[model samples]
Target: MEYRSQGYKTKKCGQTVLSMITGKSVTEICKLLNKEESTSIIKDLKPFLESNGYDTSYKKVRTFEDIPNNSIVLLEFPDESLNGHFTLKVDNEFYDPSVGVISTYNKETRLPHSYLNFKKNPLKD
Candidate 1:
């Protein structure tokens, strides 16, 4: 699912990850939790996944070496300094919700500081 961040939906990046991982639409998610704000969506994500039998965790990624494709990492963009946004990393490219396209990871764009890698899978596994 391709989601572009706008207005008060600052946490749309996390929403994008959830949408891709769960194959659920934003509208469905909103109805499920009765939440319309991005911050509320993000805050309720972990519990929602947990209740659905998914185990979740966060890992600090200092380098790009150990991270695999389709990994969700929280970071901040050049313009947004205070907020930590989330995006899915596929190969050397990133699918960011804040932006409308996939961006290549390079020196000029550079990775964000203090990344919190988001990971989730089935609890039964």
Candidate 2:
């Protein structure tokens, strides 16, 4: 998948990540979630992905090693108010919506708090 940027001072990381996964525009994702721009609907993410033919699983982890090679990771930043950020990891590459592709988790100050693993459901395909 291509890297999608949230742009400067935007809280559309969730929307951006969803767009990257679904090949939908960020505006379309916001409308799907019934949300305004910059507002987070992360709580609705799992149900949306599942409904879209994706088999999804969510888990918390202590280290980057605990995260599977290919998954969507929610990284928690030091800031308490902002919701977690999402990034796609495929093998050794990290596709961050805010930045471009990164090789290491250390490049992000945020820590990997949890992850959502997803793959297309064969039955739905």
Candidate 3:
């Protein structure tokens, strides 16, 4: 999967997920969505993806076992000062768009984040 950083956008999590699903660059998505000074809103993202044929749902994953394989997950940090981050899970590997790094989910307690409880995929799946 392509990893796009949130960069200057407040909704980097949403933007990265959209980029992964739509195959669009972050800049292109910003322009396409007319997001000039801000970023895409998480709530607005659902309809857009749904219109494009992705079947999406959301949930707050309280435990490590709640995460599903081969899916894009919003990793929410407990700190309210920082915007939550996003990660993509492909099989056993996890990708962080912020740094474009891939790592294994080895049940590290320091993970410090849980799934945002949001889920979505192509309806045609």
Candidate 4:
């Protein structure tokens, strides 16, 4: 996955992550989510992905080990609220929209709080 920067500070992370996953521009994602710029607490992400033929499952995680490889994860920054950050994880490497590629979650000083697992539905694909 390509790294995308959240240019609008904290508000754009969700849009940026959606862009990375769907190969859609943030503007397009915003339109799809019926927003002007940001996504509302990720409330629309699962439905949007499902509408696009992606099978998605979301759940809270207690530790990094609980996160499956190659998934979208919500990380909590030390100074941010729970599920305050969104990024992609593949093979233990993070593709953070706020930053860039990171080797580990600890390196970014973020805690993995939950994850969203998505795969293209075979029937839809």
Q: Is candidate 2 or candidate 3 better by TM-score?
A: 2
How does candidate 4 score on lDDT? 0.77
Instruction: Kindly report which residue pairs in candidate 1 clash with one another.
Output: none
- Order of all candidates by TM-score, from best down to worst? 2, 4, 3, 1
Ranking 1 against 4 by lDDT, winner: 4
TM-score of each candidate structure, all chains considered together: 0.61, 0.86, 0.65, 0.85
User: Number of the top candidate by lDDT?
Assistant: 2
Weakest lDDT window of 10 consecutive positions for candidate 3: 109-118
lDDT of 1 by residue, 32-122 (tens): 7666655422356666656555665545665555556656666645566665666666555666666654655553454544333344554
Q: Looking at model 4, report the run of 10 residues with the lowest lDDT sum.
A: 35-44
The list of candidate 3 runs beyond 4 A from truth reads 8-11, 36-42, 104-125
- Model 4 residue pairs with clashes: none
lDDT of 2 at 11: 73
Q: What is the C-alpha RMSD of each candidate to the true structure, in Å?
A: 4.2, 2.3, 4.2, 2.3
- After superposing candidate 2, which stretches have Cα over 4 Å from the reference? 37-42, 79-82
lDDT (C-alpha) at residue 93 in model 1: 66
Residue 119 in model 1: shift from native, Å? 7.1
After the best TM-score superposition of candidate 3, give how far the Cα of residue 96 lies from its true spot, in angstroms.
Answer: 1.3
> Model 2, residue 61: what's the lDDT?
80
